[model samples]
Target: MNINIDIDFGNLWEALSAIGTIGAVIVSLWLARKDGKKKFQVVLKTTIGMRNDNSIDETPYLSIDAVNKSNIPLTIEEVGFINKRDGKKVTVTNQNFLIDGSNRLPTKTESYSLAMFVFNQEQLFKELQKKWPQGKKIRAYVRDSSGKHHFSKHYKI
Candidate 1:
């Protein structure tokens, strides 16, 4: 039996190359979105660790989880908090830590959580509790790797 090798692998190589690139892109997008979703997940029940009649200490315990899904890993970009008080909405700087693109979050995942303290600025909570009239509310903003808005939710507390 004679062996023949007349196949033209040029097109085959090109097709494989193109498919690889597209697969990589789709995987990258999936990973990015996954990372975005894991940016702000709570590890513990939302609670104000310490508080007083005149003051309160807020401690936020959170665990950020992201599935790379891509052939590459993702990095945590930024974190911020927004508060609306007395008809004025302001943005506050919050610290952040790196989150692992792997299914297993980093060891310091607990540290990624951020807590803020507000004396009477949290009138919204009071108002909702009927302690005060309609007032300001607190909201959280979450951004993704692409600098695009991903998460925005208002919390009375």
Candidate 2:
């Protein structure tokens, strides 16, 4: 008895074409995802010691820093905190800690650079306490010029 084998070159070519198309689609998708993602980070710092710039400021203050970790520059629009309990937002626009006159909002930050906003800690605490008594947890946030918000970890006030 003899066995017979059949080779279908047409079907083999069609299968190879389908595989190539699938691979091309996958590579395109991967590249698109990698290029479309944006990176942004925020850091919150608090200082209780006296600050001396022009005159000695004995009041404590809170600093919210917006850091540009991406390769591109980003603009910082505002920096403030949110009440964790009631979800209330507070925007700090006055009483900055910088004496060099460079601490302004809507500032541009270069790659690996940081833009910071400072506010009187006691003033902010009193304002927050008026709405949320007995203290509450708050998280710092920075809003970009594009209206995107970046947040930091929670801190008790």
Candidate 3:
């Protein structure tokens, strides 16, 4: 026995058009989501010494800098480090020891600009060491005014 099935080219063209329309809709939605998401960058720096007039004095400190990479401006509410192992947070509130200290909290950081919080190296190190003696990794973080938390990659404690 022989069986012959007829396929219509017109119907096949319509089906392909439907698939293309669906794909275009999906790409549009994805791009919209990507554009709506917030973009904030965090950087960590350690200063072990300060050189002044042929003299390099020991000024060990850790600085957490948050830069607003998005078009909108955001205020940095807090900056700190968290132990990656146990989720322990160490917030540095006292600005007395900050290398470039701010007079108050929730400092405004404009787009493409940064706000830095500095902490005495020995002081922060001691506190973190006491909290997690065996933990060797930590991540720097900054909380924005809208309660959005932005974090950096792990750094060896």
Candidate 4:
């Protein structure tokens, strides 16, 4: 006995095309999610300002502003100022400089400020001005609850 079968080429092509389309959609979605994770970030800004005191006169300070611009919350590990030329870092950690030592930073809509007192404002400003052209930077080191580290862009102060 002999068996005979017929294969429809057009239907096979259509099925293959549908499978390819589905696969492409799955890959695209996966890539999109991965890129979305990269978009979750924190931004840091630094400024020098003067605060007046009634009896002690005016004091100048450096203010560090950290903003969570991502969809997820972040735990700030360290905040610092770096002298690019000498590789010297002045960090808030292990020091009493930070006005608020709290570590948690809320998601996208929240911001935190850390203040460091400048003993001599004019001297500090002069040094910063010279170093600013040489790549002085403010750095914020942060991590997610999952312990994944995220570094903010090097902000030129």
Best candidate according to lDDT: 3
Weakest 10 consecutive residues of candidate 3 by summed lDDT: 95-104
The clash numbers for all candidates, in the given order, read: 0, 0, 0, 0
Candidate 1 weakest lDDT stretch, 10 residues: 98-107
Q: Which digits, one per residue and each the tens of the lDDT, describe model 1 over residues 36-131?
A: 553343211243434446576554433222222323333334433345454333322322221122121111222243422222334323333442
- Cα shift from native, residue 130, model 4 (Å): 16
lDDT computed for candidate 4? 0.48
Off by over 4 Å in 2: 1-36, 48-58, 95-102
lDDT, residue 47, candidate 3: 66
User: Whole-model lDDT for model 1 versus the true structure?
Assistant: 0.40
Q: Which 10 consecutive residues of model 4 have the lowest summed lDDT?
A: 110-119
- After superposition, which runs of candidate 1 have C-alpha atoms over 4 Å from their true positions? 1-45, 48-73, 83-134
lDDT of 1 at 95: 23
Candidate 4, residues 1-157, lDDT tens digits: the string is 9998987667778989999999999999998786556222544544344334535334444444445544444444455456545666554444343333333333232223332222233444555565455445655444434555445567655
Shift of residue 40 alpha carbon in model 1, Å: 6.9
Query: Per-candidate TM vs. native?
Result: 0.29, 0.68, 0.76, 0.44
Query: CA lDDT of each candidate?
Result: 0.40, 0.73, 0.77, 0.48
Error of 2 at 88 (Å): 1.2
> Per-residue alpha-carbon lDDT of model 3 for 42-83, expressed as tens digits?
878786645557677587778777778877788887777887
